[model samples]
Target chain A: MLQTDSLKFSYPKGQTFGFPNIGCKAEETLLILGNSGTGKTTFLNLIALLLRPSSGELIINNTQTASLSEKQITEFRAQNIGIVFQKPYFVNALNVSENLLLANYLGNNALDKGKAAELANSLGFEHLLSKKVQELSGGEQQRVCIARALMNTPKVILADEPTSALDDENCEKVADLLEKQSKIIGAALIVVTHDHRLKSRFNNQITL
Target chain B: MLIKIVWKNIWAKKLNSFLCILLMMFGISIISLLINIGNQMQDKFSKNISGIDMVVGAKGSPLQLILSGVYQIDAPTGNIPMSELQSLQTNPLVKQVLPLSMGDNYQGFRIVGTTYPYLKHFEADYAVGVVFKNNMEVVLGATVARKLNLKLNESFASSHGFEKEGEAHGDKKYKVVGILKSNNSVIDNLILCDLKSIWEIHEHEEEHANETPEKHTEHANEATEEDFDITCALVKFRSPMGLMTIPRLINQNTKMQAALPAIEINRLFELMGIGIDAFKALALAIMLISGISVFVTLYNALKERKYEMALMLSMGGKRTKLFFILMFEGLFLSLSGYILGVLLSRIGLWIASRMLDQNFNFDLQQSMLQKEEIYLLIAALLVGIFAAVIPSLGIYRINISKTLAND
Candidate 1:
């Protein structure tokens, strides 16, 4: 489970935000819909522990993360939370298989080639395992990004505008794939995006 | 995995990394080359002049006298009368005096007329035959025997002057009696003979010239004055008192001048030091420029890859690991540059030694690396670390939310 309580943040000489409380349980999906400049990316960053909220309480797997040190927070985030960003960004220097392996490496776990190949097989990109990420098509790269986020089987998965750039067909296919993968891994899935097409896909939805 | 990331990153920016390496190599090669040459030259000079304390010769440049009498690489000032050196030979402050009579050459190798004490000073053992005991017999040094392809009992006429194309003393042929083993000293390039042989050769030339019609009377008056003149005398003092007093006594009171080998060699080094120091400064400047190039390359790369770095951080990679990735890139370039520079310098020195052997008959082959080069490697690595550290500090300030939000 992942939960946040009255998350507030402010940038110097800029906007201040007082976000609503949100929670997601295992095998559940939550969609946060907002237009531009609604702080959707900032909310995803705070959930991923990439940004420290000024006044908030973040609980992942029943552990309060606000009190943890910076190093502990990094370790906790790596082992328990997965992040899938927009535009399917992969390290250009690494091949598809190495890119998957990088997730395990960053999470401080032993490399699991078997797990990587299994995820690739399920996502239907196992044949492109040895190929560079740059050579993949748009749909293929998004599927690879979903597989990488599931590498460590985290307790929570947070995605930022994952379907904004895809067409109607790929956007739905990507949303279905992300929800299916999260359910299979028994993780709480939360996606923050400005796309209106995803609003009907999730029953638990919020608009900012 | 960290290593793999570091290697991949370096390969991704191959051109910039190679430029940094090339610059470092230029600086390192110059430093290694100069150090090798300086050390070898110092070794050769010190080893060759260890026993000789002073050189007594006709009054002129003392440095020229030491160069000719001690190193055998320069021309003598003039010949001093043998009668004038008698006092130095029997003086209480002098331990031993070895007289040198030069003015002849055989195929560019100097022929020196000296006693067995000169060979003993360098510990030169005969390679094949015995030492020369007769006036017209000669003992060839190892280099001369191998270069000229001369054998024992073979006779060769000496040229009248030091030049290779000088007039040959055809009437007096000196037979090779011995060949010495290589001892890495001045003796390795000389042909040794008795002092009487050079004197007799000059006397014979004078007599043959007197038989000519026009100059017979003019040369006859000079015959009595030219008795047994020698080029110089190598003197070793019995005590420190000789060093304090003998050189000044000879310079002020006698026609002969005393030149200390230690003093002249120091003067030569002081003159060469100006050039070496300038070259060293140039090398250091190149090294600093290379370091700056590395800094600029890495800093710009960090700016361009900020999103990638943020992506890695969001994937749970530690900020320290990202910092090490850039640091390892700098270290990799510097390490490879240093290794290549050392190899290039050694090959350069080998080629230089071969050329000197073929032309000047001086051996300068040193295959071992110097201890100072280890310090140089450390310094190069420190430069690499210093260059990488400033840019790597950017890792601490990367606002992951801002960077990813912008992307």
Candidate 2:
């Protein structure tokens, strides 16, 4: 579960962002929509604990993240939260399967190759395990990004513009996959996007 | 797993990695080869000149006299009659006089006619058979015996001079009576015989003199001793008194000239040291540039992989962990280059050894590991770390949220 109350952040005299309080439980999906230049990325970063809130109560799995030390914050974030980037980037030297296992390795969790393969199988890219990341198509690469985020089985999964580059067909498939996987792992899923297509699919929604 | 990443990342930039390794290898091999050749030549030079104090020969270049008389590598400076060196040979300060006559050669190995004391000078022991008890009996040096495959009781006639085209002294043959152990000196390449054999061989050039071979005691006569000619006499003094006055006395009062072996060889080494020192400096410069290239390769890689760094950072990979992984790349490259360079140097040494063996009767011992080689390896590793340290620090500055958001 993840909860945030009156989260506020400022970028060194550049801009201040005052966000709404949010509460999402296990087996839940929250869709936050915002227009361009509306601090969508900043909000995602604040929730990722990459940037410490100026003032807020941000909690994940019932632990207060605002009070955690820098080292503790990194460890806590890695163990409890997973984020899918707006655009996918990978360790180009690694193959598709190793990219997935990287998350577990970086999280200080035991590498589970079986879990990676199972994720690939469910996401319809099992045969592409040995293939290089650059060899995959746009849709395939996006699915891989999704699969990687679930490697450590975090309690909170954050998706940033997950379907911004996909067509009508891949956009729905990736959304359904994310929702289904989060339900299986019993995690609160948060996806921030400007796409109208996903606005209707998600009933629990907020706008920035 | 971390090591694999380091290795893979290095290979990912193929041209950069290849260039880096090639530079370091060239630098290392050049230094290694210089060290091997320098050590071997110095050891051989000092070993050959150890006990000898002076070389007295007919008038010529002192360097040539030392080269021919002590190292047996050059032509002797004309022949001196044995009578001229008689006074110096009997002086109170004179310990021993080794009369070396180099005229005849079997195949290409010089037949140095000297006494048994010459072998004692070099500590050359008999490997097989006994010392020659009669004239015209010869003891082959270890390398000469092994290379020419001459065995005990085999007889071979000498050629007139060192060249294969030199006329043969086919009238009489010298029997191989013994072979000496290898002492890694000039003697290892020579064939030793009694001085009487040289005189008899030269005197009988016109008269069919093998028929008068029973006159072996001719050396005992004063007339024959006065008439005999020797290329040079290697002299050892009992004290420093002889070195000061004997060479000056011989050069001024007599027709023969005296040269100190130590001074001549030392002059030669100092001249050659200039070229060697320059080559070593060039090699070191190349090594420094190679280290810089490694730095550039890693730095560019870090710049290009900013996104990947941020992604891994966001996944909770410690900056220090990523830093160590990248640092290992430089270490691996340096170490691999060092291994290859040493192997190349050995190959070069082997080729040189073969050439020296053929031309100068010299062999370089190859199996010995040089202390400089070990030190260079450690230097290579330090260079590796020094090169990687700056670029790997870029890991800590990556802003995971900003980088990922911008991407």
- What does candidate 2's lDDT look like per residue over B1-407, in tens digits? 67767876887888999998998999899999999999889999999999999999999999999999999989889999888878987899999999999988998999988888998899988999887778899999999999999999999999998876699998889999999998788888999999888877877773454435444344335355766789999999999999989999999998999999999998999999999999999998888888999999999999899999988889888888999988998888888888888999999999999998788777898956798888989988888889988999889888888888884
Best by lDDT: 2
After superposing candidate 2 on the true structure, give the runs of residues whose Cα lies further than 4 Å from its correct spot. B206-223
lDDT of each: 0.88, 0.90
The Cα error of candidate 1 at residue B146, in Å, is 4.3
Tens digit per residue, CA lDDT, model 2, A1-208: 8999999999997689999998899999999989988888899899998888999899999998877999988888888888888898899988899899989988999989999999999999999999999999999999999999999999999999999999999999999999999999999999999999999999999888
Q: Which 10-residue window of candidate 2 chain B scores lowest in summed lDDT?
A: B213-222
* TM-scores for the candidates: 0.91, 0.95
Worst 10 residues of 1 chain B by lDDT: B218-227
List ranges where model 1 is wrong by over 4 Å: A12-15, A124-140, B146-174, B202-226
The best candidate by TM-score is 2
What docking tier does model 2 reach?
A: medium
State the number of backbone clashes in model 2: 0
Q: Residue B162's C-alpha lDDT in candidate 2?
A: 80
